[model samples]
Target chain A: MTVQLQRSATVAGPVRRVRRSKHRPIWEEQPTIAGYVGKTVALTLIVLAVLYPLYTIVLTSISTQATINAAGGLVTVPGEITFAAYRQILSGGIVTRATLVSIGITAVGTLLSTTVSVLCAYGLSRPNSFAHRPILFLLLATMFFGAGMIPTYLLVSHLGLIDSYWALILPTAVSAFNVLIVRNFFMGIDQAITDAARIDGAGEWRVLGQIVLPMSKAVTAVVALFYGVGYWNAFFNAMLYINDNSKWPLQLVLRSYVLQGVTLPGSGVGQVDVASGAVTGLPVKMAVVVMAIVPVLIVYPFVQRHFTKGVIFGAIKG
Target chain B: MSKQVADAAPARPAGTAQRGTADGGPGGRRRRPVTGTAHRRTSASVPVRKVSMWAQIKRDRSLLLMTVPVIVLLAVFAYVPMAGNIIAWQDYSPYVGIVDSPFVAWDNFERVFTNPLFLNAVKNTLLITAFQLVFFFPIPIALALLLNSVITPAIRTTIQSIVYLPHFFSWVIVVTVFQQIFGGASQLHRILAGHGVHFDLMTDPDTFLILITSQAVWKDAGWGIIIFLAALSTVDPALYEAAVVDGASRRRRTWHVTLPALRPVIILLLILRLGDALTVGFEQLILQRGAVGPGAAEVIDTYVYYQGVIAGDWSFAAAAGLVKGVVSMLLVLGANKLAHVFGEAGVYQRA
Candidate 1:
C-alpha cells in the first residue's frame, strides 16, 4: 500500500505539470474580443492612473522655467530640460542640510533599532529562557494599547528628550511589531541546528551571531528596510519634538516646502526670488519631493523580492 | 486596518510549546537538553536536580543581558507613557506635572463627550472610514483577480511592482502629488479655467471625503493586493482541474472554488478593518485640514493632536484619546470573538 501511494504521488506531480503546460485551464478561457478589449483598457487605465502623476512630477522637476511658464503649471512634455532645480536644492542649502539630517537619522536609527530588535527577538524566541513569557506578554501588550499623544509627549518632555535627536531615534525605536517579526523568523530556524551548537559548547551569543543571524539575512534585511523607510519618511516626530528648523529631516522640509509652500531663508529659492522669476518654486518643490523619495526607490528593488516572503511569514502565521 | 490586524496577532511560540512537552514541566526550571556527545555523557552520569529560580536566571545570564536594554527601552518609552495616561483623570498641566495635577475625576471625559467640535470630528472620522470600507476595501481583491488572470508572469510582476511603488512614499509626497494634480493652481485647474470652467477637488469641502478616500486607495491598494495574491497562490490548481473535469463553467468554478478559498482571508481583513474604523488617517487629514478647514477634515487622532498638543487642553485630549484607545481595543476583541465564532484563528487563539 505504501509503495502504491508513493507511485501515485510521483505520478501526480508530472501529471499536474503536464496539464498546466499543455492546456489552458478552463476557468481561464480565451475571452471574447470585447471582453479582451475591456480588460486591456481597464488595466491600462489603472497603470496610467498610477504612473501619470509620477511622470508629470519628474517632468516638471526637470523642465526649464520657460517650459513651466508655458505649461502654466506642472509641465507634461519634457521640453528644454535643465538640472537647475536639482542643482539649486543640492547646493548646500536648507534642502541639502535637511537631506543630510535625514540620511544620518535613517542610517543611525535603522542600525540601532535593528540591533535592539534582533537581540530582543533572539532572547524572546527562546521561550525556555527566564521570564520569557512575561517579557513576551509585556512586549505584545504595547501592540494593542498606547498612551495618547498628550501623555507620550509629556513623557518625552519629562525625560528632557525635547529638541534632541535622541527623541526621534529613541521614543519610536524598537518597534514591537518589527521585534515580533524578527522573533518569528528566529523561531522558524531549525531547532536541531541550535541544539547541536549548544551541544558543541557554543554559548548563546556564538550560536546567535555565527548560526542564527547568518541564516536570517533575508528577514533581517527586510526588517531593516522597514525601519529605514520609516525613519526616512517620518516627519511628524520632527514637527512635534524638534523646535529648531535647522534640525529638520528631509520629510519635514518636504512637507513645509511642497505642502505648505514655505520657502526657508537660507534656501536658494526664497519666496521673493521665486516670485521675481529667478526660479519657479514648482521645480524646486518637486526636486525636494524627489529627493525625499529617491532613497526608498533605490533600496526598494533590492528588497522587493523579499517583501512577499517577509510579509507572509511575519503576518499570516503570527 | 491591515496594520492593526498584523499588530494584534502576536507570534505564537509553537516551537517552545513543543519543547515544553519534552522538558517534563513548565515550571521555572532550566533543563539542559542532551544536545552533544559531551553534554549527553555528562547528563547520563549526573542526575538532574532542582535549581532555584535565581540559579536558573544566573545560568541564562547572557540571554538575560541581551534582553535588558529592550526591557529598559520599552519600560521608558511604552510602559511609562501608558502609566502617564492617568492624566485623563487629572487636570494635567505641563507646569504642575502629572503628580501635582489636581484630580478632576471624569470631568475631562465629560467635556470631550459634550464638545461640539469633538462630536464633529467623530462624525467626520466615521464618515470617511465608512467610505473607505465601502469603496476602498474591494479594490485590492479585484486588482489581484485581474492580475491573476494574466498568463505571463513577467507582465504580472511588472504591474505588481509599479502598483506597490506608491506604498513606500511618505504621506507628504502623496498629498503634494495629489495637490499638484488637483489643487487650485494645478494644470487641470488651468485647463478648466481656459475653457471658462473652474474646479479644485483637492480643497473642495463638499467632496473632501472622496478626495481622501481616493488618496488612501491610490496609496495602499497595490500593497493590499500582496496579501491577496499570496492567498491566491496557495489555492490548489488541481481543484480547478477537478472542476473543469466536472464540466464547470468559468464563473461557476470561481464561485465553487476561488471564492471559498479567499473567504477566510477576506473575512479576516474585513474584521481587522472594522476594528480600525475610528482611526481614519491622522497625518493625511492633518496636512489637509488647513486647506479644507476642521469642519471637513478633523478626525479623532488629529483632534487629539490639535486639542492636546496645539491648544494645551492636555487633560481633555487625553480623555478623548483614552476613549478612542479603549473603544479600539474593545472593537478588536469583539471582532476576534466574532471570528472565533466563524472558526477562524482571527488574531490569537482563545486562552
Candidate 2:
C-alpha cells in the first residue's frame, strides 16, 4: 500500500501533488494543511459527539454504585463496574416485563408491516395490472394527507383497541411510505423476468414468492428494519392508547424512569438501593435506556447496507 | 447498494424457485394468452387486449386479493380516522360516540382560534419548525458533501455506522442520552457548576429552542445524509474530470458540478420540509414538556394530545389538530406549486 507514493509535503505544488495522488486522483489538487487539520478536527468532533454519550451511558450503566458515587454523574473514566443494575432490571422487574413487551411488539409488528407492505407493493407493482393505478393512488394518498393525532386516537379507541397491542401494531403496521418504498423497489426489477415467468405458467403469487422477493431482499430487509425500529422506538402511540402501565413498552418505561424521573415501580430501583446511596436509580435508568437501544444495535449492522437501496425511492427521502 | 444490485441481478431468473413453480395451480388454463407472446419475443412489449372489467378482475383476482389486507388496514385505520375528523365540529363525547355527539358547527374552531393556549402551541410549533429548517436542514447536506470528499471508503462507512445508530433509538432514549450528558446533574452541568457556572439545560426556557433543535439534528441529521449521498453518488465522475481539466478549482467544481446535481434533491427535500413544518418532533417535545414547561415546549401535536387525550377536551383539541393538518396540506401544495414555477420537480411532477 505504501509503495505507490511520495510523502514530501513541504515541497512545491508539483511534489505535493504526487503525494496526494495516491489518495486523490491526479486531477484533484493537494489539500492545504489548514484544510487537512480542519477536516480531521471536524470529523473527530462529529464522531466523538456520537461516541462519547454512548460510551458514558454504557460506562455509567455498568459502573458499581460505589463507582458511580465516586465518579459522580456519568462516569467517563470507568472504575469498578457491576451487573447488579442489569440483573435487577432484567430480573423480572417492570423493566424485564417492559423489555418482553417491546420484543413482542417489535417482532410481530415488523412481520406484519413487512408482509402487508410487500404483498401490497408487489400487487400494485405490475405495470398494468387491473386497478393497480387506483390502488397505488389510494396507498400514496395517505402519505401527503392524514387525520391528525386526536382523530387517529379516537379511531383506535372506537375500534376498542385501547390498551391493546393491536393499538400499537395494527394502526401503523402498513404505512403508505413503506408500501411506496417496496413498490419502487419492485418496479426496479426487470419486467422481462416477471413476464417470462408469467409465460411459463407462474401465477402472480409464484412470481412474487419465487422470483421477485428473493431479488429485492435488500429493500425488504431495509423496510423491515424501518418498521422494526419504528415499533421498538415508538412511545407516543403507547402513551396515547395505553393507560395500563403493564402494557407500557420499554420506551414509556424509559420515559417515566429516566426522562420524567419517575421512580421505577414493581421493584423500584430507588426503593431497594436507598441505604447504600451507592445504587441510586441512575444505573437502573441507564440500563433501561441500554435495553431499549440494544435490539436496534444488534439488528442495525446486518441491515446497514440495505438502507441505500431502501431510500433509492426518492419519493420517501425527498 | 451497487454490490447488492450486482449480486441480485446475476442471480435472478435462474429457475431457482422449483417449489414455488411446482406448487402453482391453473395459471395457464384460466388466464388469457396475453403473456404467450412474452417467451417467443425477447422484448417485454406484449400485445394488448381489450378485456371487459369482469374479465380483468377475474384475471387479476389473486393480485387484487394480495392487496386486500393492506387496503383493509388503511381503510379501518387511516381513512376511518380521517373521516373521524368530523368530531372537530362536534362536541365529541366518548360516551355518546360520534353518531350521537351533538354537531356544534363552528363552535370548536371559533374557540380554538381564540384560545390563548392553542395560539401558544401554534407559535411554539412554528418557531421550532423555522429553527429546524434553518439550522437542522442544511447539516445533512453539508455533512454529505464532507463525507463524500472522504476518499477512504472504510473511514466513511465507519463514521456513517456510528452516526446513524441514534436514528434507530426511540425519542425516549434520545432524550435520556441527552439527559445523561446535559441534565441537571449531568457531567457537563457538574463540570460547569464547579467553575461557578450554574445552569440547568433541561429546565431552562430560554435555550430550549437551541436544545430541542440540536436534539433533532443529533437524532436525524445522520440518517438524512443517506439520501443526499445517494444523489451525490449519481453525479458522474467525468463531469468533475472535465471541470478539473478546464482548470476549475475545487470550490468552482463543487459550485458548478456538485451543487447543481444536488439542487433537485435539495429543492424536493425543502418542499417536503415545508410541508411537514408543523410536525416539529411531537414525541421529542412531549417528553420534555414537563421539564421545560409547556410554555416553551408545547407544539400543535403536544397541545392536541394535552387538550384532547390528557384533559379530555376532545372537541377543542380536534379543532386545533384539524387546522394544523389543513395548513400542513396547504403548505405542501403551495410549496410544490412554487417548485414547479421555478422549473424544479417538487414531490411529484404535474400530470
Candidate 3:
C-alpha cells in the first residue's frame, strides 16, 4: 500500500522542487510552457478516448425509446431517465437465476481455488523436497502447453462432471499462474522462522498451517481475488459443458442474452420486438453487464493496492 | 530444469565416485593414511551410513513430505493430460473412450491441412496477433513514460486506476459496452446524425480491425504498463543527473538514458508476446463475430470451438488445437534460445 504513496511522493517532490528554483539549470528542471500544453492536450485526448464509450453505455442505459430515436443515438446525456430496464431485467427469471448461480459459483469456487492453490504452492516451496522440482516443472509445462480442449472436455465428461457444479469448479481449481505467484511469495518468507518450526519438532503440515499460512495475508488475498474474478468471468467452460439451464453461470447467460437477443417468456422486456431481433430499444443488456461485473468491481478496490505486484510476478524477468 | 536437478541429485549413487575422488578426508570416503590403529579409529569414527542416501532422505523428511499433495495433483491433472496428447493422432470418439478409439494414423493432421477453415484460422490468428504486437504493444510503454513524468501524484494514480478498470471487465461486458456505444443503435451516431453529420462505425468493415485493436489497448494498456514502469524505476537516477550535467536536453536524455535502460524489459516482453502469438483474444473475437463476420475475426481457438464444439467433429478440432499448441511451444523455445544467444538468462539456465 505504501508503495503507491511512496512512488507519488518521490516523483512529485523532486519535480516540484526543481520547478520552484529560479536559478535551476534548464536541463534538470521540468519542461517549458509549450511542452506543458502539448502534454495536457495528449492526456485529455487519451482520457476522453477511454471514457467516451463508457459514458455512451451509461447514457443509453437510462435513455427511453423516444429519446434514442430523437437523438438517433446518445453521446453524453439522455433526454429522459427511467428504471424500467433495471426493473424489467430483475423481474425476469433468466437474469435473476443467472445472477444467483454466478454468485454461488464465484464464492464457492474462489474459496476452493485459493485454498488448493495456496496449499499446493506452499508444499512445493519447501526446501530439500522430494516432489518440488518435478511438480514445479509439471505446473510450468502446463503454463506453456495445455492439453487443449478435446481431452479436457473428455476428462470432465468422463468424470461425470457434465451439467454439475463440479464441471465449472473442478477443471479450474488450481491455475498454474496463481500457484507460481503464491509459491514465489512463500519462498520470499524468512527462513529463520521455518527453521525455528523445525527445531520445535513440528511436522510439515503443522508448520504450513500454523506459521506460513498466517503471515501471507497479502498474497493469499490477492490469489483469492484473482480466482474470484476468474470464476465470475468464466464463460467458455460453462458454454461447452453445462447444458442444464439451472446451472448456467452469469457470463454464459449474458452472452446468450446479448448475442442471441432472444428474451425468454418472463423476461419482462415486454412482447418481443422480434422485427428488430434485439430488444432494439431496451436497456436490459446494460443491466445484465452491470449485474455480471458489480461483485468484482466492488471487491477490486479493496484489494487494488496489491494489483500491480500480484500480476507482475514473471513479466519483468521471464 | 527438473531434469537437471534430477541428474544432480545428491542421493543418487552416480555422484558418489565424483564426491569420493574429489575429497578424501574425514568427511570423504577413503581410508585415512596416518591412522594405523583400528582402536583409535573406532573412538573417533562417525558412521558412514549416516551420510548414506536413505539417511540423508530421512533427515530431510519434512521437506519431502510437504510436497506430496502437489506431486499427486500435478500427476493426476497436468502430466496425465500431456499423456492424453496421444489422442491427437487418433479418431478419438467419446462413445468409444480414449483407449478404445481406433488409431487413425495421420488422418487428423491430413484433414487439418486440407481444410480451408483450419488454414483461415491459422492466418487469422497470426494476423490479429501481429496487429496486437504492432498497435497495442508500445502504447502502454509510452503511457507509462508519460504518467511517470507527471508532476502531480494524485492525478497520476487516479488516471492509472481508471485506465486499469477495463481490464477487469469480462470480454462479454466489454463487447456489450462497445455495442451500446457504437452499434446500429449507437448514441454517438444518433447525436451526430441529429446535426446532419452521420458517422457510423458499427457496420464499417474496414474500420473494424482498428476498433478491435483500440478496444484491446483501452482494456489492457494500463495493466501492461506496470512491467515497463517497474523497469523504469530501476534505472539509475545518477545516469540522468550525469546527462543533465553534460547539457543533454530532456528528450535527448530520455532517449539516451531511459529508453536504453528499458531495453531488456522491452525485449523480455516482446519474447512473451512471441510466446503468446497464437492466442489473439479468443473471447473478444468470438463475441464480435456477429458484427465483423468470421473472415476478419476467425482465429485458431474460435475455429476449433466452431468446428469441434459447434460442428461436433472432435477429432478435427483436436488436430487444430494440437497444431497451435505445437507451433506456439516451438516459437517460445526458439525465442528463449535466441535470448540466450544475446547473453541474457533466457527462461532458464542452460546446462
lDDT scores of the candidates, listed in order: 0.81, 0.81, 0.72
True contacts kept of 2: 0.77
TM-score of 1: 0.88
Best model per TM-score: 2
- Deviating ranges (above 4 Å) for candidate 3: A1-27, A59-75, A78-82, A269-281, B1-73, B190-205
Considering lDDT, where higher is better, how would the candidates rank from best to worst? 2, 1, 3
The interface RMSD value for candidate 1 stands at: 4.5
Q: Is candidate 1 or 2 superior in lDDT?
A: 2
i-RMSD per candidate, Å: 4.5, 3.0, 6.6
> Across residues A216-305, which tens digit of lDDT does each residue of candidate 1 receive?
988999899999988998889889999998899998888887788776775644353545342357788888888988999999999988
Greater-lDDT candidate between 2 and 3: 2
Q: Could you give candidate 1's per-residue lDDT for residues B40-107 as a string of tens digits? A: 32334444464334334444555666777788899989889888889999988889988899999999
Winner of 2 and 3 under DockQ: 2
Error of 1 at A11 (Å): 21
Tell me chain A's TM-score in each of the predictions.
Answer: 0.88, 0.91, 0.83
Candidate 2: misplaced stretches above 4 Å? A1-18, A21-23, A266-279, A314-318, B1-48
Clashing pairs in 3: A72-B190, A73-B187, A73-B190, A74-B187
Among these predictions, the greatest lDDT belongs to 2
